[model samples]
Target: MRFMWLPIVESVRMYLQSLPEIAETYEVDLIGNLPKGGGSSIEIDWEAERGAAETVNTTGAVAVHLLIKHRTDDTDIWRAFREQYRIQNLILQEIRRLHDYILTNLKIAVKISATGVEPLGDMVRPYYGNELILVFEWKGAIRDGRYES
Candidate 1:
């Protein structure tokens, strides 16, 4: 049995990179976490933990953290606020799109549990970031003392 998370992250990265608006508007980067940088970028981190297998059922969770950071050289408050809202909208759209696709496409009996989005903070100059969290739980049959879902 295999439980690879990178494939899911890669899938998301590819989808985001293919979006015309995101491709032309932002530099979407997929990594374990956010690094020090500026401009517009995105980072998606996959986290998961295995659960004990019962007599006939196996379960676990898959979570992903999607972080989006948008920065600008301009320090004007109004402009910065405008940019923030614009980037926020774009990120939200992408998150919704990704979630819907995954919920419908993944073959396994995985279920999306909770999702949330929040502003990272207001520290960096002319920069705004939002964090999106997605959790998926899988409950499936055990096979040969192993879980494959």
Candidate 2:
């Protein structure tokens, strides 16, 4: 039996890369582990996988984290908040587009299960940053698989 996690991750990366907003706006990285550092960047990381074998098919869900970060040196708190908010909206718009694209092209089920905002304070003297965490649950299937003892 085989899990389709890696393929789905790759597909998502390719799809995001194809978007001009995401591609041109931030540095995109497919990290094997949780991301670090503070900057304007988009990091894709695989969080976890859950599955079960039922008769002839295997069903599972893979959790992918899309981390969007925006950092500013401006001391104005309101300006930093507004910038992060704007960036969050832009990323969410693209994600909504991706949801439709996945349904039509990949023939897989995808949903945004959770979202969060992380404030990483002061990496280099008043470098205020906000990180948006988007958790995408991707449902996938594996056919013609047999469990061997």
TM-scores of all predicted structures? 0.64, 0.64
Q: Please provide, for model 1 over 16-109, each residue's C-alpha lDDT reduced to its tens digit, 9 standing for 90 to 100.
A: 7878876775676676444566457777777765554345555567677767666777767677666656655665565656656644554345
- Candidate 1 lDDT (Cα, whole model)? 0.63
Record all residue pairs in model 1 with backbone atoms less than 3 Å apart, i.e. clashing: none
lDDT (0-100) at residue 93 of candidate 1?
63
Looking at model 1, report the run of 10 residues with the lowest lDDT sum: 105-114
**Candidate lDDT (C-alpha), each:** 0.63, 0.60
lDDT of 2 by residue, 1-149 (tens): 34656766776677667777666766666763434554566667776666634344444666766655555667777886776677667666767676776555555556665467776554343444555665555444533332212
Instruction: State which candidate has the highest lDDT.
Output: 1
